[model samples]
Target: MNLPTASRQDGTYPRPQQLRAHWADLTGVWSFRHDDADAGLADGWAHGLPDARDIVVPFPPESSASGIDEPGFHPVVWYARTITRDDLAVAGLGTGRPRVILHFGAVDYGAQVWIDGAFVGRHEGGHTPFSFDVTRHVTGGAAHTLVVRAEDDPFDATQPRGKQDWHETPHEIWYRRTTGIWQTVWLEAVPETHIARLRWTQAGPAAVTATLHLDGHVPAGGSARVSLRFDEVSLDTVEVEIAPPARRVDVTVPIARLRNGQAARELLWSPEHPRLIDATVSLRAHDGAVLDAVSSYLGLRTVAVDRGAFLLNGHPYDVRGVLNQGYWPQSHLAAPSYDTHRREVQLIKDLGFTAARIHQKIEDPRFLYWADRLGLLVWAEAPGAYEFSPTAVQRLMREWMDAVERDVSHPSIVTWVPANESWGVQHIADEPAEQAYARALADVTRALDPSRPVISNDGWEHQNSDILSVHDYEGDGAILARTYADEAARRRLLDRMGPAGRRLLVGGAPDHGQPIMLTEFGGITYQPDTERDDSWGYTEAADGDDWIKRITALYDAIRASSFLAGSCYTQFTDTLQETNGLLTAARVPKMPIEDIRAAVTGRRKQR
Candidate 1:
């Protein structure tokens, strides 16, 4: 995979949207051990684990990259690392009284942190970012022992584990379990009271909004100063006053370039343009002292579903997308490295896909960053719970909100998928409680980020959705073409269609004028090189040429249908036990890149 060197490979600036120059990337080697019997806490392992072996940080022990390729049922894992003053200095920190904030990009299931053996903080939600201010517990300018205990129960069906398998061995769709830290770990230096959360959105075609959530109540004489820049041209800065006790402040800035009416469309963000405007926002006191400042960026765009079309930047867009589960052959879910994200995005685009569904996983932020930078649309979906219960919905809500809060600012994310195939609410086809649960997911995601279109449930049984997307694996292109030949035929098909030919929607909502697309189809399994036990896909192809033929035919079916405005192919890469990806698990293209591109774009493959 001829991937170029990735920036921030050492994990510096893990959170690019809220970047700080004075930060440390604590993501290399760490002492690791597993507590299979769950006796570490009682045995005082927080101070240090006995007989611990070295394991790579940010990659779970279940993965090969972590140097501990043991895929056993160790629910409890422990990790210890030291952060030194020289480490901080190398990260561009100076001798100062700034508060030290420890940031974890993500940890699976549950995480508890201790600084120098003193409990600092604990957080739930495996795929969401969290942090703690360890300044009070740390020794000034000295090395501090940081210990983390992570717990993930494989048999916990109420948890939103995505594709992580519960059984001893991965089978069918489920893969290996990632029990602990699976993303970057870093630290930052900030003021006593600083920006805790920053979000950006398109307020209008001519303006954008920035919302900053403060760590504490607004101090007296508090004001937020914001400056905007487009293509290197800085615009006038704006400042807004915040009253006492107001923890959140929303500031809107009129984009000067977007305000230019006729030429404004040139600055609009799309899969073709992908124009991002740089921004620097600061929290200042009336005395002109900076309390907190953050540098960020936003794209000027609008996404909507209207009259049987998916609109991007207020214009209809052909969503040639592929479902990406965010897995790897080595690292499971943790992107093997940051550069791997760039290569994935480039490969998706190279195959003529304008978007990625980001199926199931919330995805690494760096992947979204590259999508924002490299002109590709994204549908950010949440991991699903396997069972339905009050606990399940509660878990789903907490993590879904965290996922949205962490990823809402990205310009590449144009769609929000709260559920896929109704995994947790499996009985939504009849049960009111299950139906309401599905609706709540959509409502919550829309409530959080109202800018993007929300698909309540992708694949089937959508109660309230801006677009209706169904997953069908019918391989015969001619039958697909005929089923979608007309509006009446499409409606009849949807009324009787699910991924496996079940009911598609509740409340008879198909009459509503909204876009409908084949979100998952054409899983043509073709591994001409390797063999596996019970490897499965929707359809089986003979060889490389047969694979290309089936791919082109499937794409042609979708393109030939006038009403099917958009489509997402079954997947991007071959995951474990699933051999139906345009590229292999190692990210090597299955066929010629150009041939795949031709098929993806509805063009005939050259002889």
Candidate 2:
């Protein structure tokens, strides 16, 4: 099997036509060493050439596959590589225009890019994509040195480092910290005045609007002719004038061009039947000259809360989900490959859950791509910090907006969670700062993507949001607490004072009343002595039958509660040492799969 290089070894980097393969994947053959470079570029001595040190692409330098079979490394790290146009052109650059742009899919926490000594730019967030215009820096078809300096301060609790335990090398809950570039690094060449960014939105009926954001110099006389297609069907073909260097033109594709029931149609996207339509976008001059082209895909689906029920495609659909950690045994934060991500999704679906709560960590876009294609609903959450400072909050929220814009096209995402269990709002004791932070984040998330629901805080504090979402490990404690609160004189006294309980429902009530989802509930860890045994044991090894009984009992308790629309187990697999998972560490079923499936799916023949 052939692998991708920084520049195509054959001198050709694939074109936008091969967008999926567009990235040169400079993951392998890159020289690696531990370096503590300051954020600001400083003059320093470095190796003249990239040594033959190989670190696997998308994996941290400390991993075994990165040619360094070790765990611990200093937070500051550096990566150096050289790219050649001749090598790229052979790979696929294909004698196109000499212009080229370099892209870094993602880097951890912070990174600075340097092209042969001149600093181009720097990015703060670790989980989103960033790019640089290196066309000017390239010495015309010659090889150029590209350097990336990355640092992740594990002790800096102010930043959004989710489940990343600095002190604990690899423990129950925390996984390895992915430093430097943990995503694909690639380069591409395009027309000088080409399309920079494009967005498509469906606006009911046969009206699908396309917006084209152009960059560089636009022809003063000609208009931008926009053309798009879904499979063999041509959805739109229109000509709109580009006002100037940074102006964007909006065009509506005709509904009739969509073809029969397929043309300009809004098809439902769900787990049972994952349907997707591939789209091709092109920019052309008024004289019919094609300037640029790119391909993308989208799913047609909407999620909302209506009349005390979660609705998908205007129908009430019960959301049975599990909390997905987005970590793997083989690669930790970095998945082994695309196939590994697919296998995890398949495991979720096979367990009979339709949705997953992607807790804390901002998952890779490829994972979201699979969710959109496989019909898995997602409640995407941003990594939260334990403490909230103004500058930190501002930076985290800005990064959140960038993440949303990059992933808004995906259909699997149904909600946004800005703060998780620790940020603010103590479940038992809600601090004023925590409450204030939750309220502020809720407002910001809505302003960014009002299309989806925002959970101000997933658990503990109920400062704000579209749904009454909670994470409780009380072990059927809500039931007993409710009973006691209803009977306690203190509750009666508080009720007599005014509508205090009303404030309990975060975000007030939805237009249709706030629906409650026990987003997290049972985390019954059952590890049998034999790997192939069918026993459910909690904590340590309890009676095998007792474990199953307790899980069923918890399900009944949740189902009987009117406040909770549904519940999600703590997790599907036993991740690392925190073996509180329904499934074993290897994703093997611990109990009879059908038994748990019946309880979760509400298919127990009704008493």
Candidate 3:
């Protein structure tokens, strides 16, 4: 069944009353309809065009919950809404302040935003958030019109489009395209002289530092007071002198307050414990006046790859994780609510998996936030298509830089995987360029966030990487780990199949002490409805009981192998056309949850 749709201009997701305490999701009915090809919304013709047609906010027009469930034809989807300065005032915007910031959670492909009658800004990336300062556009208490025009070519090869196959009916590997704004749009007020941005890091138990960049001017005070709260309790409060351009503000909180060291034991956030601590930060003037306050949260957890074993909290830990694409049956690329997003993460955790490799797509910031709080480890990956251009790679690198800059603060993100299996690199005959791009991304990612490990390319050629990775789906579980019958048998197998067969035999879990991860494997598709077909992992109608046995045996072999560190199962949920998933498309549990948990956690079944 489809999710409920909201019908008000000022309503949030689900309803206005159940707003998430931490966020304000401006998702509801808005004025939207098809525009003429001659007169477009971008050319300021949308000023007073009285088209009160209904369109759901936050859901792409093509989605089932969008109220308009028709397929978008790659045409420009135009949206216009008449919002007053007072609208911003209710959201703590334009409240006697000369500066206001309007933030869009995400927009597909390219978008142009016009506030009132003037153009504000345009952004390119379809998966990341962007904002525009629209204070000057507001004229007194009068009404202002905001218009956004978005265009998306879902099959654009060079762009980082993941699993979005336009022009094709529902297929095996790809699903529907989500265009226009699929996330929230909200405005917040900030003082004329205020802290514009902050990049911070936690060095140790007691110390944390941030480099603040003020937008226009710092407040008229030499000292700025900073306060950090953890769930209503102040964790750290300190006063520091403001540097003109910028200065690093360092604060030391008690070990109990920071909870950095205690996390290893008492308060460590883990799937088993799932402890979360809130942090609300506020910048203040020397006179004890609060300047700006934004709610934030942090988890204290560390992941390391050492001695050919993955370690969490300084102990050898095996990661039974899944490769989650983060797509929904109805919402497609977007989750209907923060609760919906949180439910997915909780499902991963509930399945006895400690981590998840978010495959092929840069997820919404909320996913990372939920992972951090819910104690689910994440391996953030960049979307890789079958083609790549140098110019496109450069832009991708820039977006990756921004993604890292924005996501580095979260403890749940343990690794950065820049490419998946060298899909596009193969097209380039010059091996040097391909290797250079791979190495360059590794270098840039490491330079950007040295704390996390970076996997160069998931599988394919394996050019250069901090960790040796493979995507193996060899024979069934029994044959994959079994010793090759002989050199002739191995050669015959290699000759019959392609490079994939060769990699399975030759790679054999790298002998080097460096970490070895089965980044992709075990995509057993179990479609009970189609029982004639027996390939349970990748095909429908496979033997349900046999599927479980094979997967469990595969996990057993990998867990016993000394060379392998961890394995991420093919997927968590069955995405649209790809039915190889542990759970059904709607995220309903397929097999017994206890059985899957037993296989993953290595827990001995009770007698």
Candidate 4:
């Protein structure tokens, strides 16, 4: 059976800076073969795979969208597709001696790319984007063979696998494993000296700072100019001269100057009013001719933590959030379409959630784009490995750094979570090395992007964390109310049994000043399909009305706590057999949306 596909636009991936660059979508069917024996390399399979089966690009073989529909273990897989000269020509790569780059949105575990049977590059880290220049490997008017090898070991604890099931079948909380490509694959044409990266920051209430990284070489006396806009209205234009061997340039634009003495707050961004500003950057030759141009956007906002409260734009903001796993029933990690991202964020907002903790996964940039446009706060999390080893630490650190660098410019992402529930560093509280690693991760995150708060080890272990967060699954509201009635009482409880009774704090003295949040709770399971014996939830609800009552009570308990800044409900949608979600796996509401919204927003009480 075929799974439903998402509505995709022409150019959906590579978000944050949706540049107006020459590009082509390399999705759809491709030749596929399972390298069970791992003999593709010795077999010279990169040259061709004529006997291979057909599968869709960007969707893993385990997914129905790939046309494989086999969820069993496949350690190694190979994909082959032919890129014709027309494909390159359409992307402006056929002439002008432009560089042709092949971009892979994400590949599972490990990936190797070969062009025209020549090894181009290899990349590790399953959930990050990687690219290679294939200009030299392809002829201008001829077809070239593109091949990829993906290797994944789901049982290997050294790699960050998130919730991918290690067993042959789905179990407990883990779901089916994803293998091979699971995101968009595309091609782009760029000048030899092109804009490599664009990083933006709100310098102050009145200005935005943009840092540009250039690749290749720049001729002497070349220059670059940036044009700023707000809602299509011209803001300001800044220019900078570039010398040969130059790579980095910084430019700041003052909004007041663009608004003709208007205050910066006139165009401030908030959840209630998501205002975005567009920017276009152009590189020029000494003769003032435009060599390259790319388009991007930014939202003007600031986030801070002050006195046990999360502040947005200098005002205390309560984070009514849900734990979004970023999983789909059919596509697994990949969204069915770019529109699905917008709809999901809209659903969260419609359900009265102001924020969402993208739990245990580095989500797609398109999803973050919608979050920014729709004004939804996000807690970006790094997927965790199950074991504590040197390899695990290295992999986690590299991928986490990549994730942070890729998402730092997004205004919707207010927080960074490096570890969750002590998944990888389980002995962080007892082992000095683990504690050091966790602290190092937190430090690295802050060093890369200090504007946002970092929850070092969310849901327990309180080492080097900006926010004091805990996860408790107790179903009783009275218990939650009594446990966190006051800061003194909460500290005493932490001293006695530690957070979650696991000794989350090393010295037993909790950080009194940091904001406290119930990061995870209220996993009341409601299995609408009672006939499925395999389905399960964290805690069973007696009925729909009982579920509402229990959920409302938990929200009330959270609101009543003097020390709590906010809370995140267990999850947004169900996945696999874990049916503890406000929305079912198919994105259907299990209960009245208004009732849940009332409970979450604290507008009404259940009699």
- Best by the TM-score measure: 1
Better of 3 and 4 by lDDT: 4
Candidate lDDT values, in order: 0.84, 0.64, 0.66, 0.83
For lDDT, the strongest prediction is: 1
- Model 3, 1-607: lDDT tens digits are 1112111112233212112122223567776755536357545554544555677887887788878776656456777776764576565554435577778877887888886667888998777778887777864557888878787766567767666775646566677888888878876566666555555465675555554556655555645554455435555666666665553344433335445554436545666665544433445666766665544445555666777667775677777779998888677787877677678888998888989998877787667766766678888988765576876686678777777877776677888988877766663324677767877888899998887677777764444466656677753655655522333533443334323642421222233455667778778777655332223345333476777776787787676564667789887988766778888878887787877787777785687
| lDDT tens digits, residue span 362-415, model 1 | 888888888888889998998999999999999989999989989988889989
Clashes of 3: 5
Better of 1 and 2 by lDDT: 1
- TM-scores, all models, native as reference: 0.96, 0.84, 0.86, 0.95
Clashing pairs in 1: none
Q: What order do candidates take by TM-score, descending?
A: 1, 4, 3, 2
State each candidate's clash count: 0, 21, 5, 2
Deviation (Å) of 536 in candidate 4: 2.6
Off by over 4 Å in 2: 1-22, 36-53, 90-96, 139-142, 170-172, 221-231, 234-239, 254-266, 424-434, 476-512, 529-548, 591-596, 604-607
Model 2: residue 72 alpha-carbon error in angstroms: 3.0
